[model samples]
Target: MDKTPLTDPALAQLFTQARTYNSWSDRPVDDATVRQLYALVSAGPTTANSHPGRFVFIRSAAARARLRPHLSAGNVEKTMAAPCCVIVAYDTRFHEFMPQLFPSRDFSATFAGKDAVIADTAMRSSTLAGAYLILAARALGLDAGPMSGFDKDTLEAEFFPDGRWKANFLCNIGYGTDDQLFPRNPRLAFEQACLDL
Candidate 1:
């Protein structure tokens, strides 16, 4: 595949002009678009291709009601107003799929008895997938508001009662409104945030 820089508009859409929205328009994200978003997100690389992320897209009134009690006070209104709220989660038994994901060799045993390694890998990779989700949503002309302000324990119990998947974060998705937006914040310059090594 030939690698080329993305067009300026694409860059702006995915990063420069993209904002974490707080208000959503009445427009809804259709199921087909959500499916496309996942197809893009799943293609992103993960540690040993562990691919641990599991998403629960809350689009119904009943699902949102179930999630409402778990959100922080500040996040409640915007989240409930959005057309969709995605529960970005990680699978605890992610390594079980290693044989299929990393078929060149047996990598599942590396995480079999090591609880710490399993948790760490799953969390890290799932978070990467969450970031991919945001980018994918933007690429598809959807808006995103990713937040961590929620009751983790209660949310996990409420959404993942089986103890298999754990919530990583929540992201509200839809057509967003700038009515509730604040001025764009500054980001660290390369010199301030990176090292030449």
Candidate 2:
């Protein structure tokens, strides 16, 4: 397969067009799209390939209704208006999957009985997966709005009380409206943000 140039007009636009969309069209995102996004994101890297992230997508009115009370007032309307909302969560027992997912050696035993290590690894790796979700959505021509404005404890109790799953963040996905976007903001230059060493 031929690779497109980095300077290709379409590729350039895709990079520039990706934005945090706060409002969406009335259109609905199909389940297949959600699955495709997961399939794409799962291929991204993780610590020891542990693949700690788990996603619970809420598209039905009933599911979204369950999420409503947990969201801050500022987030309630936009979340409801979105075609789909994804609950990006981490598994507290992600090490159990290491045998199947990592498959190189049995690393699961190393994490057993270590609560602090488990929590640290799970949150960091799952957050990376959440970032992968946003990029994958952009690649698929979808818009996303990711926020941390919701109540985590309320969310966990309402959605994941089994103690196995921990909430990371919430992202609303759909076709975005330009009217809802603010002007582009400044970003630090590479020289200012990166270190060669």
Q: TM-scores of all models?
A: 0.98, 0.93
| Residue pairs of candidate 1 with colliding backbone atoms | none
Top candidate when judged by lDDT against the true structure: 1
Q: What is the C-alpha lDDT of each candidate?
A: 0.96, 0.90
lDDT of 2: 0.90
Tens-digit per-residue lDDT, 1-197, candidate 2: 99867666556445665678899998888878999999988999999998899999999999999999999999999999999999999999999989899787989567989999899999999999999998888888888899998999999999998979999999998998987788879889999999998
Worst 10 residues of 2 by lDDT: 8-17
Instruction: Give me the runs in candidate 2 sitting further than 4 Å from their true place.
Output: 1-7, 10-14
Per-residue lDDT of 1-197 in model 1, one digit per residue for the tens? Answer: 99999999999999999999999998889989999999999999999888999999999999999999999999999999999999999999999999899989898579989999999999999999999999999999999999999999999999899999999999999999999998998999999999998
Candidate 1, which segments miss by more than 4 Å at Cα?
A: none
* Residue 1 lDDT in candidate 2: 90
Residue 168 Cα positional deviation in candidate 2, in Å, after optimal superposition: 0.6
